[model samples]
Target chain A: MSDSLNFSYTVDGENFASAGQASVQVKKELRQLGIAPETIRRVSIAMYEGEINMVIHAGGGVAQVNVDDSGIEIVLKDEGPGIANIEQAMQEGFSTAPDNVRSLGFGAGMGLPNMKRYTDEMHIDSTVGVGTTITMKVNY
Target chain B: MTINDIKNYLDAEVLCGEEFLEKEVFSACGSDMMSDVLAYVKDQAVLLTGLMNTQVIRTAEMMDMICVVFIRNKKPNEEIIELARESGIAVLTSSKRMYEACGILYSSGLCGKAE
Candidate 1:
């Protein structure tokens, strides 16, 4: 495996069913590269949560994954109504998603928390009515 | 328990991945909330949920779950089935409700992974 590999994906918010495609691809690529299963699981879960959040809140976004010898980094950027209170949003059981999304089995307010939990490092940047960018990293 | 046993026990209809019927499952989790599943980690487990969507399959994939059982007689759409099939995760549907389904599995010795 190479020391570093870069992967980019464009997430479409128009289709809820299509969310998590980027995470799936990253999982496959990591498997092919023979990364550890635990590390892969953490990366994929963090990325999947980010991907779902992008669809549900941001109306779609861009995902970039960088795999290297030391670790994996995932960056999710979206141009949508930014998070009003990062502190409140980080709390478990707090959600702004509509009832419809909840019915689909998501919007449990665990997305950001799970991302932070699974990744060794995480960063969130958002501007009101502008956009949000989340960076997460999981060490191998 | 093996996935085959789950199908027979729940009278579930196998929607995909028949080839994996013999695979062993050590634990199981029942939830419609993907976040809850993400909050917990399991090994070689089966996910039982009422949520019939792509995120369910994706959640199972992230957890390395080998099987997904949809309760309440709910059937997954073609796209969901396709996603599960591609990910090599078995999909099953049962007429039992979520509580009954989890109860049966628990009594049969299927438990959630330890923290």
Candidate 2:
């Protein structure tokens, strides 16, 4: 084992059903690397939430994952409508997702909060009408 | 409780992961909203929800849940079952409603809180 390993993914915006595929793959990879179950769960949940947000709000994105002896880092970048109010968006129940999205079992305004909850550290960069990029890390 | 115990107690039909019947789960959460489930659930819990969708299984997988029990006799489609099987999550369908199903499990010693 090296000190770190990197994995990258291109998220597709066209299909909602395939949103979490990248997270699933990352989870499998982490498991194969013998990361602790709790750490894997945290990483997978944060990444899955980010992936879903990318599809629902960002219209698509790229996810890069770096695994190392110290921790796992996930970066999600998208070129969609950026979040206008980071504070409001971080609120648990404040959501701008359409009703159609809610019907699919997401858009409950818990995405960002969940990401923050499961990760040890998180940072968000956004430009309204331009895009948003989220970086999250979970320590092993 | 073991997955098989849950199936027997709820009179549920196993939809997938039959081989995992011996697996144990300590807690459970029932919700239709996947967001709430992911936000609050803990390790190795069983997710009992009425929501019949592939995302339900995906949510369970992300949370590292071991089983998903669909209440109201709601049966997930083939794709959903396939996804659950791939994730090694036992999928079960029960005729009981959500509240009743949860109550049955709660009283039967499957506390909803994570350890």
Candidate 3:
């Protein structure tokens, strides 16, 4: 495909069980497009982490995926309470998530790090009490 | 090892995806934390966890895992099992504890390293 393909979805903030739906759909779409399995997996993991973050931290957000010949780009924008310390948040075991979140098997403070681990590029923009936007890319 | 072998090793019951028992898995990871499972990369892996929730299935899907084995006799609810069924991931429940289950699988050659 010479032209880029774009997909967008509104991530639900409530109901943690409903999270990761968009990532699942995107994974299927990438498969139908015949993207490499490894590439598709990387994209799915990064986007899934971002989606879970939006639901757990931001109370929901917008997730957009742009697939092109060179790579895939994922944008996650959430209007939840922004991160107070990006550096600390990026740490492997630093989490601000409440006890309830940990009980559900998330909030181990690995979301942002995992996103960065699987993607080729990652950028985080945030302001306290405002919102956070994360952009990540995975090259073919 | 195939999913069937994992079932036999743990003496687990197949909760769903019975048709997929023959599918092969190269690696395995045992964790209750879904995020920790997502943090690592494993090819054609089996996830062993006591966590019973929809996110378990979702995490397995995101990682493209072939099967999920619930440890400590932990049984998932209908919603979670249905999610795994829809994703084509095998689900199994074993009476073995997490450590013992992982030990059995690991000793049988299911290393955690990605192939």
Tens-digit lDDT track of model 2 for A44-96: 99999999999998889999999877899999999999999999999999999
From the highest lDDT down, the ranking of the candidates is: 3, 1, 2
The list of candidate 2 runs beyond 4 A from truth reads none
Among residues 3 or more apart in sequence or in different chains, the pairs in candidate 3 whose N, CA or C atoms overlap within 3 Å are A13-A59
Please give the distance, in angstroms, between residue A60's alpha carbon in candidate 2 and its true position after superposition. 1.2
> How accurate locally is residue A20 in candidate 1, as Cα lDDT from 0 to 100?
87
Look at candidate 2 and give me any clashing residue pairs.
Answer: none
Tens digit of per-residue lDDT, candidate 3, span A1-140: 79999999999999899999999999999999999999999999999989999999999999999999899999999999999999999999889888899988999999999999999999999999999999999998
Every prediction's TM-score for the first chain? 0.97, 0.97, 0.98
Per-residue lDDT tens digits for candidate 2, residues B1-115, read 8999999999999989899999988899999889999988576799999887788989999998999999999988999999998988999999999989999999999988777
lDDT values of the candidates? 0.92, 0.92, 0.94
Query: Residue by residue across B7-40, what tens digits does model 3's lDDT show?
Result: 9999999999999999999999899899999998
Candidate 1 residue-wise lDDT, B10-66, digit = tens: 999999999999999999999988889988888999999998888899889989999
Per-model DockQ against the true two-chain complex: 0.88, 0.80, 0.88
